[model samples]
Target: MGTDVRDETRNATSLLESNLMAAAKDLRNETRKATRTLERNLMAAVNEIYKRITALEQVLGWYRAGNYNLYKVFTERANYTESLENCEKYGARLAVDGIIDATILRDLIDNLINSTDYGTYVGLDDRAKEGTFMWLSGKPLIAGEVRWNSGEPNDDLGGGQDCAYIRAEAWNFDDHYCETKLNYICEKMA
Candidate 1:
């Protein structure tokens, strides 16, 4: 009888140890799953933050490239004489005979055209001689390079007007009275 009792007790102890070990294995598996879930969530949040930062960086780059810098309408409203005075005040001059790239010319056209009823005088004119439209900066106008409207520089009505203006459509040139009170576009050294 004593031997049988000892055997039964040992069997019961062994069974309990096995059950405990199984429970410990289950706990470890659950902990690993939870850790993996937390890591995935953290990585997703980091990626979202990185995308937002990249978009903001692009916007800052555009602002720094002078895309937003433009001439105001008030500066363009003065006539040829007042426009020159205003340009001097603002440390700039009218768009003269200079090597204008596409970007600057596009900006000038978008900003200066159609701000008023009258055409605005640019820094180009043929006041010195006929067929000699020169920039106020003392540069000669090159032939076959002018973007003039059909039948332009007519010196219409017998040569009273000599100043140049970007037409309302911003596609061609027109000569107007230099003393006419119209807006003007000014260019400064960047």
Candidate 2:
């Protein structure tokens, strides 16, 4: 009778051991599956980031090659007259109407204004016709896109203000006497 009881106890212990081993195996399998899934997601994210970086590099390459038009901002303060002289020295001109796009405009606003306190001149002038502004490059001004400061181009002001300068605070334009001293942005043919 004691031998029978011992045999039964051994059988129960063996069954419990088998069940524990099976459970451990199942847990290991699940862990491996989860690890593989995480690896796949990480690889995909890295690949996507690499693709974006490549595309941006291509664009920068084009800019370096002068295949795309770009705006170069100057922080040195100089009047429109001096700005034009400096542009000639660098083989560039103040940005004209055709060059005004959202990208360039935003860049100019952010870079020029955030970096300096002096106003920078753009290539806008109403020298040709009163109330009809035209860029120095002879393109008509697009009405809504231009940045003009309050009470600007009021040519009636005794000071002969004819040129426009970009103010840093709000990217607004203010007409000054063409001879006023201010920094300028030059655009070269790209």
Candidate 3:
């Protein structure tokens, strides 16, 4: 009878051990699945942050000039031709757009000049013929379309005063010698 009782106790203990082992295995599997889900969600959040940073960097690279996004760089006094060349390197050109565009440039240039002796060069020129002003693209300037400083484009200064510049005081267009070194503004498509 004693031996029979011991055999029954051993059998019950073995069955309990088996049940515990299976429960532990199931718990480990569930933990692994939860870990995988957490990793996937974290990676998605990091990727979204990276995309937003890139967009902000692009916006920081440019500046607002009225209705246009422009890149303005201060350079050592350079000839009109040299200024144009420099602008070309950055995929921009000398600022010579419509009247409204030019006006915005004038305001910006005026603020920058602020009692400085140097002025800024624009893309307008009469190189094709004196008194026949035109934008750099060869588009003729309509007489009343653009405002010029009093007694400007007079060609009175001589020495090939044909490149248009912004006068600091009036912020109006005035022809100057192309060879004169000065600061300049560059424009690009927004």
Candidate 4:
């Protein structure tokens, strides 16, 4: 009887030890799972907050549209060179996206064509070689892809219309002289 009791006690202790070890492993795994879930939830919340902040920025007169960064329009008149310099000073450059050359600005602002009588400067020029236009981003402006105003980019009697200017009334590039002062658009990455 004593031997049987001793055997029973030993068996019970071994079983209890095994059960405790299994329980501990299970608890560790659960803790790890919970931690991962909490991390994911925190990341999702941070992303949502960022989206809300971006919306608020738009409400505060910042312009943004498809595939473009936040845009800042300067109504104050400035020449083409000055416009470039001013945009650079503010850590930006002239609006020179491939889409902008077409008709993206129209969607960016309602009635943008009729917004004001003043025209805007873009980061396009053929100063490198006459009749060879290119954007500041180093992308070539294929002539076939764009619509030029009546007799535009003519260099104005061989005076050389190197820079590109977009007249407000006309959505297309009616164009203007580089030396001419006008309102301009600046773009910074989002």
Top TM-score model: 4
Instruction: Give the TM-score ranking, best first.
Output: 4, 3, 2, 1
Q: Cα deviation in Å at residue 12, candidate 4?
A: 5.7
- Residue-level lDDT of model 3, residues 1-190, one tens digit each, is 9999999999999999999999999999999999999999999999898567556634655344565456454357789899999889878888766233666655556444444466778788888888888887668888776678998878866548988887756767788888989877776656
Report lDDT (CA) for all predictions: 0.67, 0.72, 0.73, 0.75
Candidates in descending lDDT order: 4, 3, 2, 1
Question: Which RMSD values do the candidates have, in order?
Answer: 13.4, 12.2, 11.1, 3.5
Mark the 10 consecutive residues where model 1 has the least summed lDDT.
61-70
Candidate 4 per-residue C-alpha lDDT over 42-151 given as tens digits, one digit per residue, 9 for 90 to 100: 99999999788778867865566565576767888898899999999878898876335345665544533346577777788887887788887898887655556778
Per-residue lDDT of 8 in model 4: 100
**How well does candidate 1 score on lDDT at residue 33?**
97
Cα deviation in Å at residue 74, candidate 3?
3.0
Clashes of 3: 0
Q: What is the lDDT of candidate 1?
A: 0.67
Candidates 1 and 3, the one with greater TM-score = 3
| Candidate 4 or 2, higher TM-score | 4
Instruction: Write down the TM-score of every candidate.
Output: 0.55, 0.58, 0.60, 0.76
Worst 10 residues of 4 by lDDT: 105-114
Candidate 3 lDDT score relative to the true structure: 0.73
Candidates 1 and 2 compared by lDDT, better number: 2
lDDT of 2 by residue, 42-111 (tens): 9999999966865774564212112245456676778787888887886778876323676667665664
